[model samples]
Target: MRRATTVKFKYRPHPKQLQAHRAQVDELLYGGAAGGGKSMFARAEAILLCLRVPGVRVLILRKTFKQMESSVLPKLLEEIPEELAKFHASRYEFTFKNGSVIQLGYLDKDGDLENYQGPEYQLVIFEEASQFPENHYSYLESRLRASGEVAERMEALGLFPRRILTANPTGIGLMWLKRRFVDPYPPEKVWRPKPSEEDPEPGTRVYIPARATDNPSLNKDYLKTLNRLPEDLRRALRDGDWSVLDGVRFSSWRENKHVLKPELFPISLLSGRKVIAVDYGHEAPFAAVWLCKLGNGLIIQYREAYAKGLTPVQQAELIRDLSKDEEEASGEPIEVVADPAMWSRQDAGAHKTKDGSPPVGSQAHAYQTVLNRRPIKANNSRIPGWALLDEKLRIREDGEPRFLVYNTCRDTIRTLPTLPRSKTNPEDLDTSAEDHLADAIRYGVMHLEGKFSNLDGLDDYVDTMDPMETYRIAQAEF
Candidate 1:
């Protein structure tokens, strides 16, 4: 009699991979430097889930079909033992004898998600998730539900619904992914999501940051190739530095050297001019940055207010409230510089009054009415403004940057470094990205640069009032 053959499969996962497999978080982001074996880890986890739990259904996604076929599919096929599972090429799925299935797919377009509407997946893995848009990712998150039977089976096997994502720092979805996963907590630290109105059923989130050095299996030649890449790409891929992007607009931005601790530069030391820069948006996000110029020609971004869906009056009130303490202490109003677009009147559709009559005035005028002062129009010169800001970000001979952002300015710190260069216009930043805070910073920087450039002599202007009052007057004049 012919004996039945038994196939034994074994996978020795790296430490990071083991951590990811053991993590009980609902959503886990395993990202960072390239060649860290992220894809291998994802494939192994997916296979294990399919093998251990009957009726387990997993959806593995890539940005493009070709990518999924050429890279992920080949590795998956190589790893799965022949006797354990059968690959159905037509459906792009693997079926194990235990009734579990692993479906390989791609989401290349915005509307691609509609194809997956009815299917519920116990595990959804997004490979190169940063390449996908935020809306697509959120839509996929809604489909991460399991049937009662499947849930019961998974629970019996110590498995749960998991959303595993792997990505690098560069991509269109960089901002939202960073905000959602990488920015909340330190690497390898698991935290329960805080409940919020928008996210009532928030789940546990974890970030596992890996570097090229972490993967000993990576070939030395491949390491050399990564090292030989341009400075930005090298930092992003080799060092796993999220702050640096491939085509970053602000090459001068160095977070470690440019960002300052709040204690080091206290609000009490804010002696120079104070300026508030606003980039208004109702549909997108409205961003406001408060900058304080010190006596040593250092411009410190101390505070920020970034929100969306607020009316002009609401934004004005928020700005006023944000600056209230400083304004009171200084005994004068802080200078407000805003986007030039705010001055343009809008009477087309939504701007109409309750009775369908044209609205009273422009957004800037309404803001002024609520703020009790007219905000000066920003220079709105993109190239020059960016140049000035870039110059300010440069480190001086004394090892101090001319411009420094306080750690509290999270939006600015997060968005500024990630802003990419415009493909059409290399000189300017890509405005389509999350550039509101960067725009505000540019406006503040331009205002300061323009104000100081016209100054004939520093000694000519003198004030008898206290330093705060004098600085306030100077700001108002500017």
Candidate 2:
């Protein structure tokens, strides 16, 4: 028989951590700048609960198992003395001598929620909680349940089932987290809470802010790294400023300058080439945006249509109808530019059209057959496309932005301001966001080829040189 040995672990809490550790709230958040020991607090809190309350189940998680191993596993191991707590490697769980369990899990995707349905955890710790969606947080908290003696012991211990969320001030969940917990409440202030429509969990919740300075022992190099981040990121990780709003890319978007109400729009001013931009999706979302670029480089995004599960033929017909009014109002011929993927040939199963003939496998072919117009393949460069979108969002000294969206394009207007920046490449939009409208806008704007930009000065170079030389210089300037 193996002998049982107990190893003790000790942890000293910083002031912010202590506030969170002592919180009697149903949901507690200890978040702010990086190097604030945000993650360390979650680890210590999990261990303490398991040790004090026998048979208590503590679940500590990050967004992915890879994140758990890389960020939490090493520190967690040092805190575990491995005494009588037998760790099951496959389960990624620790079964303490007193029947308590601490399980390390990852909620990588929404589908992973099913794995946790049966476990009634008493304490749930979200490490870097900002990386998760609000729905994930709510779903997990709903699973915080216990019955019988385990519940009695928990009651006696004065430990009601609770959730501890630790994060820096950034990620996809930034806005929701800020709205739910961070912004309304001041640091260290607890609320005697009531249920709200957005967050109906009944219990007190509090925000205890953490800063890099809070952890005197946090590495100088890590602090230096945080300081070196971009202005918004630096403010978030170093100063812990929630007002900076990190996830959104289009901070320059102003409603007055960019939105054109149907009654206010001057449809008669649209005298240049009109374009219908498309992004094709069958199971996901398909989007088409109608745009009219004026000769003065002004671009008006006048209309849009977005939906999912539509065949290419259906999409083409929808686009035709959506653009009919605008084309007639402006008395301008409209050209079509579609996503490059729309031209790809499909297999035998691709024919989704009613006719027994070939499936409308290629969206461009379908457009040609039905609308009698083949769409020009759009420029698909993501980075440059996003830059072009940024150019449109920029407001001039006249307080008029080059890009204007009609109030009719509700999806485009709604999705643009709420799109989160990609964590992997901060410069890009998070692809997981509902970005079909943005994609359609990108396809259209990129196809305009920067002709409507502030590059009209290039025409002057032509007058100073020979015809051939001037054309060469103009192309170079362009």
Candidate 3:
């Protein structure tokens, strides 16, 4: 048997992974929350085993190169002595003088693992496994079968090991992981803690839970940063709790300043192309927002939220009056952007005429047409509209964000946080919540992406179309 290294390094492991690692258990899993030393635990185990085996080949897989370069490589170099840390710059692998080789690899695409199809390793570590889809992990796992005496050594060591994974939970499908790992399972003698539920053909796998508090040497600056966050964000980042509010979008987007109010756009002073975003409602409020492009930027200059108790004609009049006022003040006609379903289409229940127009067309069209003979475009495409808004709201240099809210737009400021999900079963921001004003802003900005006559051609280089369409068009070219 190969002799274990007598060298000792100054390092500490998390209590949870430490207990499991010290045991004769085979496989182990350490997960949950940010700031936890989950990644460090995997590294410690890999190094210790490599030293004992002398030339024990280990494989460490990361989802991205950036993560490996900044995190895994730095810590591994810091832990092992300089003499043993022989660098392989060309292959991105590290070899220790003791004959242990720790190979660094990535799996951004599942096919990327074909190069290691025939390889075998005593240790395999996966960092941020959740970032990759489930299929990628399954493919890489097949390559974990180690042969020869090392396999017997693993059995004698009582290590139930096969593969390991670590990651912070995000988006949907995470609930499935929580149920499988976070929630307790029935105990079994073979897989006592029930970490090997997915091992159908038998063999050992285990999951160990961990959090940021597990690391003893965490910096005070990181703690201070956690403390300063809003209540919900603080919980997600520090507590590692998976809980969240259902209606909020852009939960991670934040500001260091106090809440500002919306401002009104005077028809006389307003310049450039004007537009409005509308969120139509049957039982809810018929909300609309007036938006204007200033120089190279966009702002939600005015917002109004009203219930649908009024007829479509009433809504049209309201929109017409608002448009006339803005046009007279700004010397530019206000082009109102509405739901695509509301225009150039038959009413939901109305009969269509020979010309294809509805016998009883949308009351929405009636109201909007009163303002201008030509209909302003309606954006029903979620992907495109979202990109348009994102481009407009993006902040420029000097620390200023691209989008701004007027002080007078109270309803928009109040309800933006409450928008519903775009999809019925999705976990993302609905994009339809108290979103009438936001929708208006999106349409206006997208309309301007095509062409702008008023500029000194400064923003002329800007494409006046939805960037999502651009991506989709590019994707089709492939």
Candidate 4:
């Protein structure tokens, strides 16, 4: 056996780090704004755990291999003293003389979970956990089991298995992470999971929110850099507000301005032209939004149906049922505008229809067959559609937004505010988020804009120039 070498390092953890280290929980989320020293805190905890427990195994994971190589691995090397462990470059791990091993791992794609199939670790840390989907995070939790020998050693040392996740409040996984970690408790409070069917051995889960102010060691320039971010991004990163997200396409979406009380917009007043905008998805969410043009030219989204795992026929049935009463009262067919992708019949395999004949090869065809009306294909241009929606969402000089959503349209109201900006096209919305409702809204708004002229009576309340054109001009000036 190799002789144990003396390990020496000094780490003065701030209050947030101290809270994280002292958390006695099965899962702990040390997350919040940028410059919170989350990465350094995770490294220190992994090192201290390995030093105290012999024959222990720790797995530290980032979302991508490039991140593991560039950010995580270099930090581990700098923090762990030379005398403590031997670096095995090939394996991307550090093996200490006391038999504890620290593995630096990456899980970028779905298939990357295969690399950690049988390894058991006493502690597993997910750096930037919000960057990964919930399925990837769930699969990783199964690998947190310990071997019998490791368990015995842990029992002797009075230490239990733990999974630590550190992240900022922006990513594709933000919604689920917020529901899991942040939503469970008030800020800075420790939360314990109650026993449930899914979680039989309900373990303590704590969330410790830290901000840029929590770490005095952060450079002033870095704080300034964070502050210099866009308004939504600055709030999410600097203030760690989960309700807001970075790169939001509809920055003007305020609950007070855009969302209306159900009683405020009576359905009786929605007697004008009505439309149903559908964004079809079987694996992902299928969104159908019911919108109507009020006489005042303000668009109200009064009803919606958003769900997943339903066949096109079932979706059509649900949509018909949702609009049944409204259609009956109006005695007129509600126009349907759907995603252009639904109109494609190419390569769509066959299925049995209700009458036992071959099914229509496309979603649009199926909906048309069921509803007895061919739906209008929406203008799917990304930038123009998004711009139209942005125009509707913007509060004009008279303090009235063109678009208003009823509180009963919960999914529409919930998802519209959180849609992030697309990286590929800065002007478009991110499709990875739960953006089906937003897509449906875009389709409805664009179709309405194409069919109807601008509201006639707005001259008294606002300027003659189009608000959207003014917005574009302001953007150009900036």
Instruction: Name the runs in model 1 displaced over 4 angstroms.
Output: 1-6, 196-198, 344-362, 366-371, 451-478
Assess the local accuracy of residue 282 in candidate 4 as a C-alpha lDDT between 0 and 100. 88
lDDT of 1 by residue, 1-478 (tens): 9999888767888787888888878888996889888998898888888888888889999999999989999988898998999999999999998988999999989778887998889999999988999888888887887777789988887677889999998887777888888776788888987888998878889989887778777788988999899887888888878887768888778889988898997987888888999998999999999998877778989999999999999999999998898889889999999987886676653443464322358888777788888788777756545656766887778887889999888878888888888886666788788899999998898787675434444333432234344444444543
Q: What TM-score does model 3 achieve against the real structure?
A: 0.48
In model 3, where is the ten-residue run with the lowest total lDDT? Answer: 251-260
User: What are the models' TM-scores?
Assistant: 0.86, 0.55, 0.48, 0.67
Ranking of all candidate structures by their TM-score, best first: 1, 4, 2, 3
Model 1, residue 208: distance off in Å is 0.4
Better of 3 and 4 by lDDT: 4
lDDT of 2 by residue, 96-171 (tens): 8889999999998989999899989998989888899989999997789778888999888777898999887777
RMSD of each: 8.1, 10.5, 15.5, 8.0
Q: What are the clash counts of all predictions, listed in order? A: 0, 1, 35, 0
How does each model score on lDDT?
Answer: 0.83, 0.78, 0.58, 0.81
- The ten-residue window of minimal lDDT in model 4 covers 452-461
Highest-lDDT candidate = 1
Candidate 2 displacement at residue 150 in angstroms: 1.7
* CA displacement after TM-score superposition, residue 302 of candidate 2 (Å): 29
lDDT of 4 by residue, 1-478 (tens): 9886655877999988898898878888886788888998999999998888888889999988899999999888888888888899999999987999999999888889999998888899999988989998888788887767778888887789889999888987787787788765766677677878998777778888888889989888988999899887887899887767666777788777888887876888777678899998989999999898777778899889999999888998998988888788878779999887886666766543465432478778788888877788776655556766777788899999989999888777667887888776567677887899988988888787673223334333224445456446433421
